[model samples]
Target: MPETSGVPALAVEAPGMEPHPAMKRRAALGLALGALATPALAQAPWPNRPIRLIAPDAPGNGNDITARLLAPQFEAMLGQPMVVDNRPGAGGRIGVEAAWRAAPDGYTFLIGNAGSNGINAAIYKDLPYDLVTGFRPISMLVAGPNVLVVNRSTFPVSDVASLVTMLKARGDGYAYGSGGVGSSAHMSMELFRQRAGFVALHIPYRGTPALAQGLITGDAPVAIVNLVNVMPFIRRGEIAALAVTSLTRWPELPEVPTLDESDYPGFETMAWNGLLAPLGTPEPIVARMHETVQKIATNPMIADRVKLLGGQLVASTPDEFAARIAADVAKWRDVAQRGDIRAE
Candidate 1:
């Protein structure tokens, strides 16, 4: 260590001059310090300061909720505050690009969701970034099923079978509402309709709360929406939950039959969120964070809270999450094409 120059400062050497002994030590320290200051402009180990986790949606949306749920667990494990930065706009392109543009240090990560990481890749003609290649998949943090809901005052259907019967009988005459055309909710309902051999008018609302309100006010006769968005309405009997889209029944709504059990076998869809690192993030940090997330998912308190939010903890391997994202993109692409659904 150089005592005269207390900070890590570089010592420039002339071509013909041999530097003094003190200059040599300071130069060695400075070069090492320069190497260590790649991301945060500091010469400490990874994450000596707070970490930023980007959630690519407006506050209170699905991504935001999941961000809050996992941030504390990350903080506990990493010995730093994991802050949630919401950069919502342009159908999530804003936040995604924001995260992608960040340095690939251990200090920044993204809460990548189905929309930003799945459907957008499928539906958009040209996206600014690539989900498969632009970011490093860390782990799938949580997965939640969308509920098939019908307004109590407007719809007479009580169960999936009855709903299927009416829709099949009416053919493509029914109407359904969702958050937006390319949203997870919209594609989920489209998947259900395809399996049930029916189609409907898709009325797009601005957001989840608006869509839920639309469902209750008879804006659309039936809608498949996020469980978290409509739980209060369902509790008040404003709407009926015909089925959930998980493979098995959701623990939170045990009475609600799964679409798989409702005769659409193997029917499963989730509004999933996962962790992602910038493309060039160090592999050691990615591995350590991946292991940390697996522990967080299995923690009893975190597990209970996820269940309470109507989500299942799925800390999938990086390869597995990447594969799942690819599968989702392909499935949504087919749905969008077959249904002639266009982004708005």
Candidate 2:
């Protein structure tokens, strides 16, 4: 053996065995890192990017205004930009679904109306999303009253009592227009008719503006809209408001009697605006949004603007909002069944 080394030749190792000490240390470190990474990912901060608030109606509608009014405040509070996305269609289903299907990461939300939030469940034969389950109730920023308006010439009814008398006399001769078949306007009138114990023909239109136009042109003699829409016309003598559908008379239209106090003692209906987020959004983010909405609604300048526009500040808690939705749903369910109103 020519100068064999002092060390003996080593035996070949098996294919698989314990890794070498240094290699094993590295492998063990990777496993430990992976274990640590999982919880870290779970605990990450919310709203990594801009937050989206979807408005189901068109841009100028009340819900859209509510979202836009609070967007800047939320951006400052949450340290992120708030974007409003208007997805108007199907009496607000498109936007409601947009919010419903958004990622539950607390970044996507909805500013919905009474139609989308309360009456849709009862009126629509089938709905793409469940309001009770698919949404997390955040806050109700504003509550607005819907007023009954009529063409100055047609039908000749001045107040709830007069309207009820006219309906009793004319039966189904008078007609009313609404944004759609399942809209809050439709349901509110339906509820009114049920309470008054009479029936009238309902004409559905593409939007509130179209319905309002129908009233102005005498295409439909009667219609209901937010007091804001009818106020200018009322001032111009184009339309006459019969009554408000809120429990209390609106300050701007204090002379107009509430439907509840006028003819139907318990008659009150409204189309409220509120904020909601997709289900499973972080609670902290929801709380932050609620606070921002309340702050904006209660601001003296904003409150004055809203009052002038015929809207009241709701600023209710999440629990109160949930209760209101439930109460509205129950009330409309009965109205739908009793009025024999169905999806068209």
Candidate 3:
């Protein structure tokens, strides 16, 4: 053995010991780096096949419309098609539960809104999945503004103020229809009743289509529906648009005024739809898909289509989307409790 300066040399006969200190240190470092890379490499590539996007509502609903409009752009960006799966029923619970149970791969996702994500949490006594913790928010596709519409022949009121006056005079027996109990329309009208100081009966249907039919046939004289769902009827002069349920008027409906402007200062009620993946999905994949969705939202063609549907294209960051969902859940839960709203 030789002592060289501050270091000592190892004997060549030493057992289970490397004689080259530099080489030994390099080998150990290399092994550690390799071990770190293995798991990163083992994770499967995202969009390896068509991604499944579930919309709990049936076809023709806003969620379905949003998923379809963004699918083409997502396919182009992700290099795989987005297969829209509509699992309608149970007040939008079927699709949400399906998505919640899916493998936490980024390939499966859900397009959910206040009805399924926020309102359901507020009204449902037993929820199978937790909205805030069970899934990862991807991005908010749009903020859906609803229109307060009434059949032309049944309701003579023109604007929100007049409608309020009519409801007051008509007493509490008047009926208003919605997609279902605890839905945005149902909740918004409850807010309307609170703010306008009127009492109107609520009628919940299985879906919005039936609600729309009720409006058309005068089975239900008044209803609040997404601008997109009710725009065609409004244009046809079948119903009168009292006010939009947003802070500002939608660009597509420039002539229309928002609820805030309709004598109910600061009034706003908008349903939002966003993409979400099951919990435990890789963060990178979520980020990638979010970026793709942002692009789709901003695409000119997509923007045009959304406008026609009376929806604004807003692709918010995942963190912002998640925060909005959390805030809305809390906000609407309070509204539901105050109004004593429950599912029928």
Global CA lDDT computed for model 2: 0.81
lDDT (0-100) at residue 170 of candidate 1? 78
Best by TM-score: 3
lDDT at 48, model 3: 86
lDDT of 2 by residue, 212-309 (tens): 78999999888767776677788788988888988998888888888878857877787788888898888888887887777777678778877777
Stretches of candidate 2 off by over 4 Å are: 1-43
**RMSD list, candidates in order:** 5.2, 6.8, 6.0
Sliding window of 10 residues with minimal summed lDDT for model 3: 4-13
TM-score of each: 0.85, 0.85, 0.87
Error of 3 at 215 (Å): 1.7
In terms of lDDT, the best-performing candidate is 1
lDDT of 3 at 101: 94
Please write out the lDDT profile of model 3 over residues 1-344, one tens digit for every residue: 45663322333436886557775675577677767777988876776899999999888787898888787778888899889999998778899999999998788999998789988888888888888878899888878788889887877876877777777887645889997888888888888777778778888887787898899998888988878778888888888888888898777778889988878898877888899999999889998987788777768887887778787788899899899888888878888888998765
Worst 10 residues of 1 by lDDT: 1-10
lDDT of each: 0.86, 0.81, 0.84
| Tens-digit lDDT track of model 1 for 240-307 | 99999888888888899999988999888888889999999999899999999989977998888877
RMSD in Å for model 2: 6.8
